[model samples]
Target: MDRLTAETKIAELTKRIERHNRLYYEEDRPEISDQEYDQLVRDLQELEAKFPDLAKEDSPTRRVGGQPLPFFEKVVHKTPMLSLGNAFSEEDLRDFDRRVRQAVGNQTVRYVGELKIDGLAVSLRYDNGVFVQGATRGDGTTGEDITQNLRTIRSIPLRLTRPVSLEVRGEAYMSKGAFERLNKEREEKGEALFANPRNSAAGSLRQLDPKIAASRQLDTFIYGIGELQGETVESHSEGLALLEELGFAVNPERRVFDNIDDVIAFIASWTEKRPSLPYEIDGMVIKVDSYAQQEELGFTAKSPRWAIAYKFPAEEAVTVLEGIEVSVGRTGAVTPTALLKPVSLAGTTVKRASLHNEDIIREKGLLIGDHVVVKKAGDIIPEIIAVLPERRTGDETPFSMPTHCPECGSELVRLEDEVALRCINPMCPALIREGMIHFVSRTAMNIDGLGEKVVAQLFNDGIIHSVADLYYLHQQRDVLLGMERMGEKSVDNLLAAIEASKQNSLERVLFGLGIRLVGAKAARVIAEHFGTMDAIMQASEEEFTQIDEIGPKMAASLVNYFAQPQAKAVIERLKAAGVNMEYKGLRVEAGEDLPFAGKTIVLTGTLSQMSRQEAEEAIARLGGKVTGSVSKKTDLVIAGEKAGSKLEKAEKLGVAVMDEAGFLQVLEGNG
Candidate 1:
């Protein structure tokens, strides 16, 4: 009726929404259905739209997600996100305990042993209990600003239970269910699938758009604190407890171990039971119990020597090699996959492990009917770690590389410099599937809800025959709904995602197409130079090479890819589907808007603007390049405070140097 009435309405609605948010997110108990919650949010939106003056900055609706960030500005962490030392096996855990004991002398150190989440490390900042910022562990000093994206994670509390200004650290991970669903959706969209959960998590967090990140169904577990303004922590373990008490989602599996022996036993137990977990765990961290003891051990230039991350035996399990399936890649590389007996390993059921190459398979003497030992190298992929030759039956069939393309029966050939056997057939279904999967990968198209199962089902069902098939999926919602797990909501979400994917700018689509040899960085270069997907597809090999980062091999891949009738058809379908085939997004640069264009850069010290990864991404966007160390080849060194050996080396070599301020100027046009 009036402004006062609207204000009252908004206040009550905010309270109601907050309560429901707490129930669904914090307590995992929902009083309102998702649809009901959606309606409430819509009503709130409508109210806000009608009475703009009633809108509050602290509104729950403001926290859903926001616009795409051009780049992450660096924030100097008050306390460093130091990496923990690692331990492998029981003995390694014991050694860590012994080291802690010897360092602390006798003060009964009780450790906070936590599962080393095989996911991306992120930092969350809360100002007076209000979630304000979230960042990636770029270089442990500075990270990209991903606050909007981080808010999408339901597990990460938007507002602390109490008034506290604190920085919490944790693993941002994709659960088994989410990962599987993601892979399935990708399959349907002919998008490339994530190799493992860790990559998926990392990619999801790095998304420029928070909405994209939120759609991925990501979860997080706070494990440590960077800084707490109004709190005192007695022990590292106590700090974790404090985080939990304050309403931050901390990993519940953490335990306090008195002795290395007990820690070792704990490690052993997890090593055996890791498969039962929902997410990946690369290792276990053994930290000194007391905060004082941890401070005593101190830093060692880079990593803290006090805490060790004892990795579980890389999570290995045995499975029977049922069949050898070969898939042709976009690069024309033929990869053999070991179809295995469904065995649980590394938080996922292992049914297939990549053979990588014929050489690898031959090296392992992999044969059908042989028992195989599989492990996630970093607790990610189900790699055929080894073949159990002793378990091979007398009648086991020796596996051989396909002499021809399995999809089109074209003779398989290996590139001179490559170890892979490749099928050159353009019309190969497997290649298209693999290419599509790669296209939707986090590093590529980044379509949410698209995962392996959905892709395979779509392909098998003929709903998606090629990458172009994805663009048509929006037109086949009912057909997809008929498939298992493809509920109406899921189908609608998938269609909406597909529709959203079209507007993802040129570089993303370029990468999503799974162009052989054209990596992420290269895709950006192509997008910038060509400016349109049609132009990029029409570009010659010479044109590709003229774009920096596009080497001859990459050029050939681009040319060959565009040359394909099938690929061209897909592109046509994608274009016709209203995919934004151009780049109109922000290009952060100063002189020419190429922030890093033509600059040979070396990043040193702790950046306060963005994580090293975010910085790297920014550098690429600006057309600048970064080298690992200072050399004659270097252009400028962006030095933060305490920029160690690299600074010294830069000074010694007469390299042009810019302070963090100058770098920020170039990065943000601050000057």
Candidate 2:
């Protein structure tokens, strides 16, 4: 065909294919058969390949996936993806309602109840009604960019019905049937199976290869709006309706209730109807319908006061405890696990449950080969709830904690004030292996391609012995390629990820060190305080204790860890491998005279000039802490437009208050 003809035809085909995609995936009404749709896509692909410049960004052909990404870029959310406080019983729901009513006074309150899909929480951003970016809600404030992967999910519209910009939050999930089919396919291919639909969905979205995510047949239910432009929404229910009109898949089961009682009833009905649905929902999310009411109710440090999640009671099943297995962790703590006869529970086949420790084993009175009741706690972890002593056979054996380390054959010792037996040998293979796994974990060094299985393989094959050894793996590219599943491309990507991790600033290295009593947050705090690894190594316990959040125990742990000769040797090796040792995050010079220094501040309502997170980061840079809620201890409250309870409380408590303009002035050092 001619260039003009091809361009016109491409546009026609693109529009037609997208309409069909929406009908089939979103509306569940397909006008064409699978083969017909595939043919349409093939025609579009051929034209697009011939006239690459004429190919539209929202073309349906993109859903087949694109070139693999080297790594996911970090995305800072405009609004934080805060988790909801949970309600397990009726009282918790009522209590939440009471709190909401108390905050709003005589104002009538309506609620929007939505099925909390058991899947990964993701944020989708659109520019002028076209899908621009999508991300995982990693740690609320930050997320990983998965735009390419998200575009492949057919239910997610590449273009909206109208031109508008917005950021929406959704649960990306795999249906039960899809999960089963995927696991069946994996089983046929001799690949490991996903534990459940939720896991399968999460794993699919995180894949660097968009083709894998596309193949998973993932779906999404857009529940909330993070940000909106060009138009306004007065209530959450209205917003959901608008989302539906804009070509987003808003769950049809959501209901608006006049009172908490009706909401409770709605939740109860869903409890029985949950399993009947193709998708899995672990709970119901109850939110104040009115946007104004939600603003009036304000938010706590972690979750909004206007919403709560009512978790369904865990599903229980009776199974035989076939055997017991124990494993050592990076911390040297030996944990016991129950090997159960395969039984189905909570939409997954259960063959293992956590025994936790010897104390838990004895407390539950568990015996190998005995019948036990197992339940998934929060529908995630499998745990033995009760043991049926009556069902125990004469051949049942009482399990005991092993005296020696399973991997290294070292004698195990119970530490003071700790229940789990520890393998004190620093050189224990299991300890080293687990530590290496921890080092390469997402929150630590974040080496992308080195998963648990790969780490274990590398360890067992004598390719790597310590976390420091990971930096040297590039030297053995040929050897890496020879290993199973590690192709030239895989080895290159893994090495690139490793090299990228080296520049991750001091906090990641500190966290990756597997220091006792040091978590991700603590690592950041320590890194910021010390400025450099050498400074941290030289810091005295008293210096560490001087920081308000660092307690004596943590201070001692830091001091002891840095004091060790082996630790120093590892640090030197890492430094030699071109790993960055200095803090690269925001840091302001220490000064008591700084306006926000040593102050506990509270931010309330919406700011016009900047996001809440931006304001918080500014305060943090100035050595001030931003907390939720208002109290006498709060040095100042930054009140924005529509400031609510926090503002009133600050006024009543005689705490100082600043408007957005004044806050901005102070941020500029002009106040």
Candidate 3:
């Protein structure tokens, strides 16, 4: 065919194929057979190959897969993906409604109830109605770019029906059938089966290879808009409708209710009907339908006051506690786990449940060979809620907390105000193994292909000792290849991932160090504040406490950790091995001259020029602390169009106020 003819044909075929994809994946109404759809795609691919210059980026053929990415780039979300406060009972739901009504005052509060899909939360951004980027909700404010992998999901449109720009939030999930099929395939290949569909979906999206995500049959349900450009949406329900009209898969299960009672009834109906659905939903999300009402209600520090997640009661099953197994964590906190007789709960086999600590065992009166009730807390973690003392036989043995470390034979000691027995011996084999595992975890060094099993194996074989040893693995290539299941390709990939992790910012390294009282957020804050490992190491406890979030305990922990000779040695080894020791993230020193420096600010209503998150980030960049509410502590409040109760509160509190124009001027250092 001629170039012009091929181009026209490609366009025709692409549109046709995308229409069928929408029908099949989004609408659950396929007009063509599987073979027919495949033929259409094949034709488009052949035509595109013939006239490569005419091929479009949004072409349906791209869904097949693309070349693997070296790493997922970090993306700062335009709007923060805040988590919802949960409601477990009717009272909680009513409490949420009462709070919403009290804030909005005399306004008819309508709520949109949506199935909270048990999947990974992702944000999708579009430019001119074309899919531009997709990202995972990493730490809310930031995310990992997964555009290529997301494009593989058929339900996600490559282009919208209208030319508009927006960022939408969705739940990327694997259907129960797809999960079963995937697990079956993995089982046949003698691979470890996924614990549940949610894990499978998350793992699929996080894969560097787009082809892997493509094969997983992942789908999405766009629930809410994060930011809309060149248009306006008055309510959440209206925004969802707009998404549907634009060829997005808005979940059809959502309902809008005027009163909390109807919402409660709707949630009650789902309790028994949840299992009938193809996808897993751990809870129902209740959100104030009107955007104005949501603005009026405002947000708390961590979550919005306008919404709450009503979690379904955990599925419970009675199982025999066969034994109690204790394991040491990276922090040397030994936790007890209940080894239970295999029973199905929440659609997964429950072989083990968390005993938490010896205190939990005593509180529950749990004994070996005793009948206990197992439930998935929040439909995620397995835990023993109750012990059936009446069903306990005389042969049941009383379980006791071990006095010594199970792996190192060191006498375990309980720290002040702590329950878990700690193996304080830094040389303990279990602590070393667990610490190494944590060092390479996703939230830490993030060295791909080095999972818990591999870390344990390496530790057992004495191939590596400390976290520093991971940086030197390239030198032990032949040794790594000699290990079971460690082929040339796997070793090469592992080494490459390890090499890539060296370039990670200082926060990851700090978190990986497994310092006491320093979590990922705390590590980020500390790293950003100090800007370098040497600075952090040299910081006094009093100096550490000067940072807003750093308390005395954490400050002391940081000071003590850096003073350790072993810790110093490991850091030196890492530095010599080319690991980045400086904070590479965006920051501006909180100088007194900066306009909003050290000021607590709140953003209200809609800004025409920038999203709310953009304003907050700008304020933060100037060393301003952007809070969610207007209070006496608030130094200023930036009120925009339709400014609500926050503005009134700011006025009442005599807090300084600025409009959008003034806010923009201040951001430019002109106000």
- Give the per-residue Cα lDDT of candidate 3 at 48: 84
Prediction 2 TM-score vs. true: 0.93
Q: Is candidate 2 or candidate 3 better by lDDT?
A: 2
Clashing pairs in 3: none
> Which candidate should be chosen as best, given TM-score against the real structure?
3
Give the alpha-carbon lDDT of every model: 0.75, 0.90, 0.89
Q: Tens-digit lDDT track for model 1 on 1-671?
A: 78888889898988888778667655667898889988988888888989987887667676577776544454546556767655545666667667766755656677767788888988888899988887888646545678788877767776777889877888898888899999999999999877678788888887767888878988888777776666777688888878867866677787887767777778778878887987777778777776655544555645786788776556688889899987777667887888999988755667888888888877888889998888876565678877788876697998777798877788888778888888766677777777777876655665666887778778877887777678887677779889998787677777766766676768878888776676666777777777777787788989888865678987897898789887787778777778788875434343574545677888776677666656766776677776665678898888876676577778889998888777677767722
Candidate 3 residue lDDT tens string, 1-671: 98888878887898898889789877888998989988998898888888889989999888888988766777878778999999999999998888888777787889999999999999999999999999999878768899999999999999999999999999999999999999999999999999899989999999989999999999999998988888888999999999999999988999999999999999999998998999999999999999877776777767888889999999999999999889988899999988999999997888998888899899888779899888998887899989888996699999989999999999999999998899999999998899999898877887778999999999999999899999999999999999999998788888888988899899999999999989998999999998999999999999999988999999999999999999999999999999999999766674547787778888888888987767777887777887766778999999998887789888988999999998888777633
- Quote model 1's TM-score: 0.59
lDDT for 634 in candidate 3 is 93
- Candidate 3 is scored at a TM of 0.94
* All candidates in order of TM-score, best leading: 3, 2, 1
Candidate with the greatest lDDT versus the true structure: 2
lDDT of 3: 0.89
How does residue 24 of candidate 1 score in lDDT?
Answer: 67
